[model samples]
Target: MASEKMEGPSAPAVRRDPYEVLSVSRDSSDQEIKSAYRKLALKYHPDKNVSNPEASELFKEVAYSYSILSDPDKRRHYDTAGFEALEHGAMDMEIDLSNLGTVNTMFAALFSKLGVPIKTTVSATILEEALNGTVTVRPLPLGASFSGKVDKQSAHFFGVTINEQQAQSGIVIRVSSSAQSKFKLLYFEQEANGGYGLALQEDSEKTGKATSAGMYFLHFQVYRMDSAVNALAMAKDPDAAFFKRLEGLQPCEVSELKSGTHIFAVYGDNFFKPASYTIEAMCAKSYEDTTQKLMEIEAQILTKRNDLRQFETEYRKALTQFQEVTNRYSVEKQAVDELLNQREQIHSSFTTVRTVAGHIGASNGGGGSKAHLDDSRTESQSDDGSSDGKDKSNKKRWFNLNLNRSDKKL
Candidate 1:
């Protein structure tokens, strides 16, 4: 009988989305995950809802959720595991209901002893390390973001997978619950490679958001329009090329934003040239004005330089002429100096000869006639140039000396 029951096949395992466990999307920040866990833990704390059995069960469920997410190896396993794999791990060796009551009793003291505000902080420590993740294309939750290691070459993606699970014996397929729009949050990738792309063969999806001038991912579900054109408009996209590329797209519903993990895909088919995408009239005009302004600034800089050069050349020429005049004046002053020196020497010699003759006449006490002396003086005066003319020339020479001294001082 035991063998037959075992052969009857075990119940299908409940697949748990890693994103759902954390109550965040693939793009969620470490802080966001910690915040979500704190809220959930507080709401389901067994001590807070002692009368509610459901709350008790939920408390344990949340504890379990925190347990897995807090570990790196476990989180990775949970992320990649399909429904079957997750179910197999979900199966405990045996059920234990007693742990819940004991865990609650220790919660307060545990928080205090550890100096932790909440259990979320415990997970946050682990999350700081997990930030080294790459892009994930798995289905994300509302306001959740993509979480995975980003690739250098490939575009990022957050995705959803649909599968048909068989539960009953050979029964036909049935539909599962379908999530609605605005179900997932948008996280703009930090330092994203510009634009988007789509791979025909991939199941990954990605969501992007605009933060500041660039893009980054954050936790929170956003309901964006299905049309890329509309999405760009809704975000008030700053990139003209990004908007234009959206216009060129063939209205793909697949490209539409839905509630799940979103990704940024970069495929060759999605590549666009500027001419291919149509841009808003205003945006194009704005670009033109921007370009024109840059050109005008460049022209103004060149014109200023040219004007400065012309002024410099004129100043140099004027300086050369001024220096030449200064040098010529120096030469003229030197010639005047030579003539003045010769006149001074002649006057000094004449004065010396007159003194000698007077001395000799005084010593002889004689005998020379007054008339004779007078005649000698008259003859000497006649041979000399006019006294007034020579006196005026001597005054002119003295003035030239003063002028030359002044020029030297200058």
Candidate 2:
């Protein structure tokens, strides 16, 4: 029966000889070759062996062999260049095997110029894992946290704006950095009318606990979304006399800012450990309302901190217990090693005694009576049994001791 199409290159591919596939000798005669192809083709023809993909493939393979062997030039090419000669020609051919009407017609392209099929198969397990969501791909080189003191760095400046048409809702912008992370925040704002505005911009560089003290820098600007770009431009050239024309544009220091679309950038620095900060925006009816919301958020944050502390305490307790157990194991192992040494000594002593007894017995007479020899053997056997029993008892004692210590440690 024709087999299924040999599952293609789905399995790991191994190079196979075309000559072997055709089962023809290198020196086979042209007539001998035509006879071989005709016989195989009749048996494996897709029409005759319906539903058999393997038979179809075998049919194609045989036709390929016959085409090359029938022509002197192609046969010579195959003989000189090997199967690669077929692959080279196959790349240029666009012939479709399924449309060929008969075995004779199929022989022209099906064998000599068949399309090259992709031979790789993906593992089902990997595909299933991906579908199950167990696969994780990290496109970023590193996570958010960075190590060692970082220099002045800037992130992509994202523009945030407040709608002037909806001026009833004031805007609150907050920037914060990690504690002891040595990062600080600086900000500036500009008006929509091409005028710079005062900002709660603070000194950007911070160190130690001072980092948290200057965590956030707030700013208020005229209600224009693109004011962020103007503010950035002014900050870039703060000494420019043209920027000086914007009256009342000097940086303003305030604990709170008025409602407006404000744009600001943060500058962070540290001697060790890279620094990162978060920027946030909120809309409220008044500055007091924003402060109240901030108070409520801080309370929630405090609760989270308490939970983290509790977890840390539990971790410490577990670690201490582990250390204690490890120490006890080490002590017990040392004791067991000593006991093993004692047992070895006992075995050595018994072996020596047995050897000495055997020598003495031999010296007593040319050959002691069988009855006397039997008694001596019986005594030696009894001594051996007693020693073995003692050794077993010692093992049990150590085993129980070791278990008791381990249980107490646990």
Candidate 3:
């Protein structure tokens, strides 16, 4: 028996402009676009209009438009080339895992089986827990450390309080796992609602030896994207969803922290094994005095930023040079083509005159045939400084030059 192949969903015959679908202008702000999408999404939600296929389609189109417009790079491409730039698999569809109902989940699974690239986000459960104050948070004083074990997929939270003096000097939190345990170190900012908003997450790096456990250092001026907030925002707006999972920390320089309570989390990364790790919080001023490693890492960060600036400068110069060369080539190519066409016209005229002369000589009973042959030979020699035989060879070479060079080597 042969197996049947499944086909993915086909695109609509007419794809409305994404800006029109979202009911926003091309120059609309990100917040305005987000607001428009949210309004339309709520109105045409599949769960709310289960029987209306039209609403369901509108919902999908709304989501699709948001996916392109929300991303900086994709939106730029779409603006420059329109929908033609997004053909093939250039855009990946993003579906929020948190908001999907049972029916939508089933449809998502079906689409996945049919070979659509669907990017799912992290569940909103942890963020909700923090907002609701349901998660346990232990307090760790400056220069103190705590050791604990977190089950797979679970997290341990620690609160670090900083006073005015400590905030001015800066703070550093470090976490190291035991043996083969792996974990992600997370930092949270307090919201006005007295809840925590996730600010940064750093993946643990392998230290000591190849078989050693993962370690994470949350030093000052080294914060990056907050995945938790991004996920929550995407869930709320739906327009901010991304195709790829956000990973890694971005280098930044911060002078100091505010005087208040900040939270840090250690999340177990292992699937089957629990992670045992130690978390420490210390004032940067004191910590740097004890070890030179922190200073060395800071130096490396500065060096990397300088290197990036230099690379950008070189890239711009090279791009300008390439454009100039391409423009020159286009102009020169047009001139060459015009000259070749004129040469072909002249060759055609000469060939016609030679044929007429041969017919005239035959009609005259070959009386002037010898004179005509001599005249033809003299003309060919004068044209190219070559004899009649060599003239024929040169014409053959010229014809070859006009042949397609698709298979020719450089």
The local distance difference test score of each candidate is 0.37, 0.45, 0.63
| Candidate that scores best on lDDT | 3
Residue 46, candidate 1: Cα error in Å is 0.6
Q: What residue runs in model 1 are displaced by over 4 Å at the alpha carbon? A: 1-15, 83-410
Residues 1-410 of candidate 2 have per-residue lDDT tens digits of 11222232321123244455557788887645655654565566555556777775666666555545655556787788765564322211112223245674435424322421211111122222332434332221111222223343221122345455323444444445545443333333443444322233343323444343232222332211122223334445564423322321222223344444444434343322355555554544445565566557655544554565576578668869998999999999999999999999888876677888888887686655766888887788768675456767888999999999999999
Stretches of candidate 2 above 4 Å error? 1-185, 188-257, 260-302, 352-410
Whole-model alpha-carbon lDDT for candidate 3: 0.63
Query: Relative to the unseen true structure, what is the Cα RMSD of model 1?
Result: 29.0
Q: State the lDDT at 220 in candidate 2.
A: 39
lDDT of 1 by residue, 204-223 (tens): 11234211111111111111
Candidates' RMSD to native: 29.0, 35.5, 21.8
Worst 10 residues of 1 by lDDT: 273-282
Off by over 4 Å in 3: 1-123, 210-220, 223-249, 252-255, 288-410
For 254-287, candidate 3 gives per-residue lDDT tens digits of 3346888888888765434677888888876676
lDDT at 73, model 1? 41
* Per-model TM against the reference: 0.20, 0.25, 0.43
